[model samples]
Target: MVLYKTPNLKTILLNVFQDGILPYDIEDVLSLLVQKHYLMNKEQFLNYYKNDINQFWRDVASLGFKRDEKKATAESNDINDLKEYPEDNDNDFNIDDFFDSDEFKKRSDAEDIDNDAFKRNVSLIKDYQGINNSNERKNEKLNDICKINQRLVEKIAGKYEKMVRGTCLNIDDLIAFGNHGLLKAIDKFVPDMGYQFSTYATWWIRQSITRGIADESRVIRLPVHLHEKIMKIKNEERQYENEFGAIDASELCKNINMSDDEYWRFKSIAYQFDQITHLETIVGTEGDTELQDLLPITITVGSKSVPPDYMLTPEELFEKKELHDELENTLECLTSREAEVIKLRFAINKPDTMTLEEVGEIFHVTRERIRQIEAKALRKLRHPSKSKKLKDFIKG
Candidate 1:
């Protein structure tokens, strides 16, 4: 018998979430790398994680997640649970504090300070004996600037992936850019000039990544050179008609001296149109309404409370009002706990109010017991005939 060792996407996702990087969509590229390299286990992952905690945070938690393990698996068949994202592990911030996590204000405050003496304090510089090119030497030496803060980069990347799509860049890339940026800063760095290496290097690393991303992004977008040519072709066609009159397709082809097939290809290239975006740009930004949008408007009005008597009309509203009244009468069959759970969960709509843990805490039961009850409740809700909707909703 053979025992195979390989980490799958699902396992990596669970492990990442368990490891305290916010439970969100895993980076597909990182998943591919993990699978290809056979470095899915904990020890190997620590090497990727420990050095670049901020970067790891961004890569793992890029998805704005609402569901915990129980909620995710309540609907999914293959997975039993989505591992819960850890509580604020470092106690650096509270779960309720959203803007504080990124710490933009503290940084902005630093810019207001003017301390020339404090600025030139380069005592942290490491000693390097032998090196050749000034740029290369500076690059190697620049690693000292953010040596400790690189760990913060790892954390952000690992935990904040859902928030920043560009975090597709992984740990090695972060370090490489940091090192490279530091080198550039070194070449530009002057003890005589008076500036802190740390601040400058931060800017350098950001520049390196931004430039790299622009280059990388340009690859995914149609090349600018191609777009330029396409635009020129279009302009020429416009000019062709403006100066030479409304020439038919055959006449334009005759002017261009291309055969029918080649002209068609050229025309196709020059006249390419972006469907949805083109309409949005042309008509002041409105496009086809998605099913997701239509309900939001009506739901918002209902949620804010359109008065029941003020809102209901005779025709369709009467039928809906009657049906809703009937449904509530049926809901009267459920117990208070069941009714509250059902209404809060589905009827009134709270996206993420009570976690299973929180619910268990309230009822003085184990989380596992809560799970069993929740599953039972959900199963009952799925087939309302099996149990009343409100009753089954609580069971879940």
Candidate 2:
């Protein structure tokens, strides 16, 4: 880790921005750098950086870091000697504070940083003694920059680690993403632009970490860019549901500027990320049953809810068997022809009930003759002794 003690702001900025002596040169460098690397235009670049370039001067002034341009011009025309950056004269303002963890805001500075290693790590950033036009020197400087800001990446990653709780990501993964953002920040850093590097780097660090979470939070990952829109739609749905008690798909599509087909496709993909509960997950007040207990073994179409055969309790199974046996015994009281006719008409132990004409064709009789046989069989079964047992199974 690159440890740095708080140094004079001028020395730090000068060492970092030595390649570009003028602010205008730094601007051009940044413009071409972002365009070549990120393919971002001016507006997109500002949005990505989370600040307007025009506001840099104002921000520096508010932070008490801005110096008078006239005084600097009069002091020296040479960039090497110009007082373009501020002297750290105020006790209240420290560049290191920019990298402080906002999570520990409630604690005092002494309480927040209790680590002895961190205390020992504090040292002034190494000067640009070896930095020059040489490739080795440039690479050395780049390593120095990355090392010095390593803690900043870790701190920023700490904040994001919470955002991705319950996700597949751990702190190490988040820190990796934060390091990528730190590299991007180093590439884009223009120290002469009047903002602390940490302040600027925070945006890139957060963007990279969040983009990583968005891309990898699910079993089936989505594009990093679409995550923003997906979050917007979800937030809108929550708000709409809270206000209206329900959501209208059409209204929600209009609100998010999505077509019905696109919204449904996204919804389907989103479902894939929903939490998976194990069949063994406990349920009920006493926690005596598993999740699978509540699920049906078989689903029948156009029928009232009834337990599948495998799900039936011992008593229910016994009752069903008894009723079926009783019905079979009652059918035996009829003549063979009458029993067969009744069985065919009522669909007993059959897939479908037969019409009078169908039964007549089967028995080689007319429909009227088959009907008389069915009526006679019903009259016999309607006798109190024969009907009494079957009546117990029917509800009023």
Candidate 3:
């Protein structure tokens, strides 16, 4: 788990690297989002769903989920047999935008541009993007529709995740939003029309998420005034810092005409509302017993230790089942208090730790007693019996 206590816009953007996982408790806040009653259910009324979502319907319908697809068509046999569509009329659709940019090229190698094939795909998107009210018939070829839409879904997935105002989200949630938006566009697309389906679908995706949020949130906590203040003042200040180098929060306090405490409160609350969950600390596991000793004296732990399996490999992955078993087994061998010290040392510890002299002050132990416990734990790790269990604990 990637824990975080705070997140800036950059941190939020980085979260999208996961594609659609909108993490943090933002999903919790989504319930607070208000869905404006503009053209209520217009999207559903218009039959706008592209590939994946459409297939979701078909599969369900086929399994006698709903009666709609039962008499629908022979073409809708399965996901692959769904639909395909050719390129739309006369427009130069560019896949270059979908391709990683030059900045990405500078960091990595340039992607292969199958110019001919790309142009055809572009034409396809433009063709479908143009589709208007007249073209959407209830009975359409399932395959042509599904294939064109699936590719389009893949393409739009990037933008829907990227274009949102705030960057905070889990990788999986962002990807889900993008995929949902892309697929939504497919079902509602009118290729003969002039406007792009992407423009339309972005709204749909946002709407789905927003509607979901509104339905679930107990109270709408994001007041419009605060949102405006955050968007205007906070975003600009950060941008100014990026452009001019850096500014202290003190400078920001004077500029914003608020006390440091008040300013930070506003900033923190605003960022929280924006759902910018990032930082290793905030996302990381809590009550991590292994991490207890590495931390400082001021820290505290209440959460359970994070399982080893959650850590990514080649960095510090321990065999979770085995490591957990080791810890459980090792605990049996130690005194209740020894276990307490070990947990306190790593999990409950905080930044800028006290020296052994200071820790002795709190525990009423001579520095020697503390030293013995620390050394004993270290010595235990040298033995193969306790090494794996000792290793399973995380450090903040």
Candidate 4:
């Protein structure tokens, strides 16, 4: 008789990676088995999975291992199928703009996806309820309609591109807003209204673009209703000025049917719209000072208060440069991958430092592996030859 015993989680993990199999390939699969009580003991796991690594990976691939391939395929198909379109009656349709709007180059790269791998991903995603027929059909229909009318959205969005330039928005942002509006139009559209769908969609698309600008282009976002009121007030003022010259605040308020308090309140809010200037804007006549430099900072020297001096003295700046160069030279001692890991871990040339798990995900490795790499890199950096200059710089 053969002896049988239940093995712990650690034993299973060790067995899974013992064959040089990536932890990513089997970690989730093992977790699922444990969580679902699929395997009662080590003997069963070894009998079913440990002996057949190929079958184990197929099971993982079926569970949507890393990426949801179905969604990517659907998106790629939507972009590809855009070439099949109805007759264009409008002469204003520029093929270049249409291609630019849809980002054809980016979408075409999706065609190069490995068929075998895609099939594996799709098979797994299907089993997980991640992509189903009903949802897929609905998405296909939505994408088709969006692509068909994409030219209309692009045309409307193009009109606002220059207007929103230098604000927190660009042409691409406007096009996204237009696409959102197109989707909304598709949902609420009544075909029996005896109006062209393009005409109806144009209103919604323009509304969406304007709303996006109002919501996003400002440092402080204002309510959409407030923005509408502001626009109404401005239109009234423009019309009133054209008919009768130079209307004061009280007169303007009466003309717009707003009370004095409301007019003053609106004016106060509107003033901020004009005050939007980037901190990077040059201020001094010599163009050496940014607007941020004018911001006040208090420094205490003895008992007296003084503004903090941001300008570095020649010697101090040279020392800082020397220290930075030395650090770079020390980092060069490490292998390229190790240097990149250290740089990313410490937020060097990056917006923020990443956690070991996040770094691992980027490199397609496990968190423990990333930890090992980080520790190894740190050990090298801590060596006397590497540490001595860094320590002196810190002390100085």
Residue runs of model 3 more than 4 Å from their true location after superposition: 1-147, 150-156, 159-168, 187-234, 244-265, 271-396
What is candidate 4's TM-score against the reference?
0.34
Write down the TM-score of every candidate: 0.23, 0.37, 0.27, 0.34
Cα lDDT tens digits, model 2, 1-396, are 110123443454344445424243225535653544433455554564465443443333333444322222211011111111222221122222222323212332222333342232222112332345677766766666666667767776776666567777899999998888767666554444443445555556665666677767765676644555566666677787777766666677788798866765665445434332334589889988765445432212122123234445455678888887998999999999999999899877765689999999998989999999999999999999999989999868
Tens digit per residue, CA lDDT, model 3, 301-393: 123312122222323344545555666677666676666566556543342345666667767898889788767765765687766557656
Off by over 4 Å in 4: 1-140, 158-166, 188-196, 240-245, 278-396
Candidate 1: tens digits of C-alpha lDDT, residues 137-191: 6555545444534543343223322312433455565455545555554444333
Write model 4 residue lDDT over 298-378, tens digit each, in one string.
111121111112233345567777887997999998999899899899876565689988999999999899899989999
lDDT of 4 at 315: 51
Alpha-carbon shift of residue 226 in model 2 (angstroms): 3.1
